[model samples]
Target: MMGLLLSLLSGLIFGAGLAISGMADPARVQAFLDIFGAWDPTLAFVMGGALIPMAIAWKLRKGMKKPLAAGAFDLPGTRQIDKKLALGALFFGVGWGISGLCPGPALADLAIAPGPAAIFIGAMLGGMALHKITVE
Candidate 1:
């Protein structure tokens, strides 16, 4: 129950951050991506703001035996730069560049604009399902 509560709280914080940071708007994201055409650097500030807390969490995690909300630290074991990782990153970047909506912000937009958000989420899920069937 505690773990579930923590998860919910974490998600709410993340969603609220996305909404407040204007990341939930595809137009803002696309403008940030548009380097040669009316580029907006606001997202860079948001990314920098996020990195500060994440960097601190990573530094703290190095000394922790277990996460506060979990029995053990379930960190990724791999540090390899393999084909699969590279290809996955490429696909993710391409999708983000094309749609201007990564998964988190896209999910956050669902409450504001249901129709397009649903379509994007549906397509994303379909891609994930396809990847699962093909790869795993």
Candidate 2:
């Protein structure tokens, strides 16, 4: 119960951050990715800002025995760059480049622009289902 509540709180905080940082705006993300054209460096700064807290969290995780709301620290055990990973990354990059939206911001955009966001989310889920059927 606590873990679920914590997860909800964490998600809300993350979504709020995405909204406040203008990450929910697809045009802003597209502009940021447009390095060859009228490039926007705001996303770079947002990423840089995110790194600070991420770094701190990484450092803190080393000393922690368990998470606050969970029984154990559930972290990724693998660090290998396999074929599946590469292919997935390529697809993700292509999708992001074309749509200017990723999972996090796309979810956040649901409140702001439901039409586009819902379409993106639907496609994303479809892709996931297809991947599960074919790959996994």
- Best prediction by TM-score: 1
Error of 2 at 44 (Å): 0.4
lDDT of 1 by residue, 5-101 (tens): 9999988899888898688888998899999999999999988888999999999999999999999988679999999899999998888888888
What is residue 12's positional error in candidate 2, in angstroms? 1.3
Ten consecutive residues with minimal summed lDDT in candidate 2? Answer: 67-76
Error of 1 at 104 (Å): 0.6
Model 1 stretches with alpha carbons more than 4 Å out: none
Write down the RMSD of all candidates, one decimal each: 1.1, 1.3
Q: Which parts of model 2 are misplaced by more than 4 Å?
A: none
Each model's TM-score, in the order given? 0.94, 0.93
Tens-place lDDT per residue, model 2, 74-128, is 8778999999889999999998988889999999999989999999999999999
